[model samples]
Target: MKTAITAVSGQLGRAIANRLITETGKDNLIGIARTPPKANDIGIEIRKADYNNRKDFDEALKGIECLLLISSMDHPQNRIPQHRNIIEAAKARGVKKIVYTSIVGDPEKNGFSPVVKSNRQTEEDIKKSGIDWVIGRNGLYIDPDLEYIDQYIADGAIINSAGDGLCTYTSRGELAEAYAHLLTQEVHNGKTYHLVGNPISQAQLAKYINDAFNTQLTYKAISVEDFRNNRIKDLGQLVGTIIGGIYEGIREGAFNLKSDFEKAAQRPHKSVPEMIEAYKQFRD
Candidate 1:
């Protein structure tokens, strides 16, 4: 079975592609990226394709049985156009199966979140396209450095999330494993897997980081509006607003998966402490 992995140059995409290559051998796995993937240096197959361009997308889907759509990084508003393009391309090519990595949120109750809405639309398109599909509703990724970990530790406090509302943030590595499992198994088809790690509050997260690094870190709960207006930058208003909405939804219990997560994972979940320890080892 041939697998074509879209967005292969990205963090989560690369992880999934690498795992697939290692499992199925290099020949069965193809990497689709706007630019060449870093794995090209290690002899993995890389194909250039722009999702926005139909011809490139069609060409990328050629001879591929299963497709892994790692949602585009373009602005939230623009994501639907690309997704529609991909759906059309996939339908025309008659791909046997398609797996989408979607954001975690509920649109009915929470109004519209750009991230969640885009993926929800994509999910509907896939379902109606007559292709077997797997939806991975992934949670927040815990990237220590990107998350202003230094600022938190230095101030002895991590700011600006609601009180003790559990978010089951998954490490990139754990997400990779779950994605690989879905890609390789037929049983996972037509299933929406809530791919999350151990749930933790911001306070627990801070303490875990502190314990792992042997430094003092604390969690400070603050209003979402204040956090968005002050802390998050570089992302324009649209994306920022969407991010703020999702976090609010998370605190309101939108991202919470069922207790059956352990059953699906078939192993104990990785806690915040473990993730911090792993990060430290990588840094060292």
Candidate 2:
């Protein structure tokens, strides 16, 4: 049996690809990316599958038994149709299973509802598509803060619209490991799992960073409008709007969900402090 992972050049894609390679080996895994050359180093067969091109998926997913559909970062308007392209192609190509990396958000409460709505639509479509499917509703990835540690110091604090609301933070690496099992196991079919660590407020996140990297920082809550216009100005409108919207959801308590990570992965997720300690060792 063969498995394919889409968006293989991305951070989450790369992490999942690596886990698949380690757990199931490279011969059975295919990395699907828009630019095949970009993921050439992942030690597997790389195939071209642009989300916008329905025909590309027909060719790329050929003979694959299972698929890991990493959610596209395309604008919400474009996502549903784009995802349909693959789901249709998967059926045509006889791909038996598809595991999607979706997100956890309250569509009514989240300013990021547009994106969440699209994902939910895709989930419904998948269930109706006559194919075996599993969906993982991922929490907020902790990578942005980890990557922005230096900037946090330069700015003298961590600032966002998240306020005192708890964010369900999980790491890409941890989620990837779970996805490897999700992609391969039939037991997870027809289920939606919340893949998250314990929820933490922005100030608690700062405290973990301080404990790990030995930096003093505080969380500053700001208005969603201010964040879009000022704090993430460098990210431009599209991304800044989406990110600002996510923080707004955080502030509204949309992300404070309990985890089903153990049920999904058959193991408990590591705590924030435990993960931070591991990160510190790697950084050192």
Candidate 3:
């Protein structure tokens, strides 16, 4: 089976492509990205495609039987249209199926958060495109930037606006494995799986960081408005707004606990501690 992965340069997209190499062997998978992938040693075909242009989208889907639509990160604006262009091009090329990387919950019910609103629209666009599809509703990625937690640990303090909000965050590596599995397995084609891991509160996250590094890292929950005004002023409005929006989702229980990954795949998800451990190695 020929499979194509969009957003090949991204964290999740690159992992999916790497796993496909192991699962399917050489010459069976294709990787597409805004810029061609640089890992020439991986021994797979790499192609370039612009997410905004339908014609360039053709280069990625031309002979593929399935497509993995890893969401575009041109966020705050342009992501939905970029997704639409790719979906339409894949349909036009007669790509047999699509697997979209999305966020958890329905748009209407998850309506309060702007992040969910855009992700929901993208999910809807994929579903309506009539492609045989699988939706991987991924949770927050434990970003390497969280290594800043190391500084907080050393200083014995962390600052944040979220207060006891229960949420789940996934390692990008774990999400990649799930994405790769869905692409190769036919059974995953028609379902929506919430790709999240262990439930954690923001306070619990501080505790985890403190415990991991063997230092005191206490969280100070400030108002969102206060966080923007004082802590992140240099980040510009778009960055601050996006950060605020996600925390708002957490505040409202958007990323809270969820059912286990669908049992048929039996894939394991990674926890916050596990991700932090791996990140420590990277930081060293």
Candidate 4:
């Protein structure tokens, strides 16, 4: 069976493409990216496809049996339209199955509802498309923590407005592995999988950091206003607003779902503390 992975040049996309290549061989896989040249190093057939351009996606999707539709990072308002184009193209090209990367939690009820509204719409569209499909509602990734590790270690504290909220964090690599497994099996068709790891509170996350790096870092729950102010000072208003929304979602128990990662990948998912040990630079 032939398969194509969209946005193959991106971090999660590239990881999923690599896993697909290893499992199904390079000949059976196609890497679709806005810039096809960027995926040349992936050692597979590369096709130029853009989510915004229906023509680009239609031509690239021809003859593919299964298509992995990686969600667009554009504004929420634009995402559903972009996804519709891909879904339409998949139907036109006779693609048998579509696998979508979606966010965990109910968009209608979550604090981060605005961010995931488009995802819910896309899911509904996919279901109505009359194609065999799998929706992987991926958990929040823990990799972002690496970017702020230095500051967190230096400050000896991890501050947020999560306030006893829990999040199930999984690594991108493992999530990719699980996706690869799902794509190869026909049994998973029409199933929605929650691809997540263990759920832990902000305080438990802080403890993991302290234990992993041997630092005296503490989890400090601050008010939303204070958290937004601090994040704005460091990361600008746009990012601060985004982070604030995520924290609000956490507080509302949006990302606290039980995951099927182990069942999907047939292995134990990595925990936060385990990930810290795997990446030694966090200790440095």
Candidate 5:
């Protein structure tokens, strides 16, 4: 079966495409990216297909049996149409099945709600597109904490608005591995799985980082308003507001959902500490 992965130049897309290659071989994989040259080194057929251009996808998705639709990072209001273009193109190209990577969060009452709602809309669109489907609602990612290690070390704390909230934080690598299975296997069709891993509080995350990097960082809970304003100051309005909204969702227990990761991936998700340790070794 020919499997095509959209947004193949991105970090998550690269991870998923590379992992799938190990199982399905390079010849069976086609990568759809907005820019093909950046990902030409990925060892697969790279097709240039922008989200806004259905004509690009029409030609790119030809002969593809399965598609892995990675959610877009565009503004929430704009994401739905962009995703639909890909979905419509995939359908037109006679793609038989599609696996979508979606997010799990509140669909209303948070700044991130719009993004969640858009993902839900795309999921519905995929379902109605007359193709067999699998949907994986991914958990909050844990990689940001590792990525912010330097800032945390300097500040002496991992500061956020999620006070004592247990987050089902899975990594991009873990999610990518799960998608590899979901995209290839016929059994995952017509199913929606919560592909999240073990839950860990922000304090526990700090502890794991401590264990991995021997950092003395601690967890500091701030008010949502304060965190939001701070992020807005640093990241500008568009991205900062989204970051604040994610924490707001976490504070409201929206991210504390049950996971079906093992069922989807057919393997136990890696523990937080184990992944941190592995990340440390990989970087060192």
Candidate 6:
């Protein structure tokens, strides 16, 4: 079973590729990225493929039996077209199956609607392409906590607009492992799996952080405007707008959906406390 992973230079892609190498073999895996040198170094066949270039995708997808279409990191306007190009290329190449990484929510209803909109469109296209497909609607990742930890500690609080909103946070590594299992098993075809861990409110998350670092911290619920302003002050407007939309999505109950993550992983999924504990070493 010859398999290809798009965006192999990315963290999730790299994790999935590494797992595939262990499960199948390096010889059967192809790593597609805009820059192929890093993937090449990993001993997988490297192919230069850019989501923006149809020819690049076409050439890279050739001879692959299955493809993992990692969503493009571009803005929504640019991302949908790029996904379309890849889906067309995969269809033309006679690829047997495709597994797409999607977001956990109804695009039309989510606070971050544009992102989920693009993902939904791409999913629809994949289904219409007549290729066997699996959609992994991944939950919000806990990794972002690492980036915001310093601020949280300094402020003695984790501030957000999501008031009592619960999010099922899964680690990127766990999500990648689920993708690997989905790719290796034929039974997963045509199914949409929600790859998420147990849900925890931001208040609970704050408690976990406090416990891990031995500090007194709180979860402060702020207005959307206040949160946006604070984020803008800290990270500029554009990034602030993007992140604000994520919290808005949480507030709208987008990330509250349940999942079969344990079943998909063939083991228990990591909890928020466990994830926080692992990061305790960086707390001092």
RMSD of model 5, in Å? 0.8
In model 1, the worst 10-residue window by lDDT is 257-266
Which residues of candidate 2, in runs, are more than 4 Å off?
281-284
Clashes of 5: 0
Report the lDDT tens digits of candidate 4 across residue range 231-260: 778877666666777887787788899888
Shift in Å, residue 26, candidate 3? 2.9
Please give the distance, in angstroms, between residue 22's alpha carbon in candidate 4 and its true position after superposition: 2.1
Clashes of 4: 0
- In order, the Cα lDDT scores of the candidates are 0.75, 0.90, 0.74, 0.86, 0.91, 0.85
lDDT per residue as tens, model 5, 83-146: 9999999888899999999999999988889999999999999999999999999998878778
Better of 2 and 5 by TM-score: 5
| lDDT pick, better of 2 and 3 | 2
lDDT of the structure predicted as candidate 1: 0.75
Whole-model lDDT, model 4: 0.86
Q: Which regions of candidate 3 are displaced past 4 Å?
A: 37-42, 105-112, 230-232, 262-265, 282-284
Cα-based TM-score, every candidate: 0.91, 0.96, 0.89, 0.93, 0.98, 0.93
- Candidate 1 per-residue lDDT over residues 141-174, each given as its tens digit: 7874325777776677877645668778777777
Model 3 lDDT tens row, 115-149: 56787788888889888988888887777437476
lDDT string for model 6 (92-146, tens) is 9999999999878657753367788988888898899999999988898887875
Best by lDDT: 5
Identify the candidate with maximal TM-score.
Answer: 5
Question: How well does candidate 3 score on lDDT at residue 122?
Answer: 82
Q: Residue 258 deviation, candidate 4, in Å?
A: 1.6
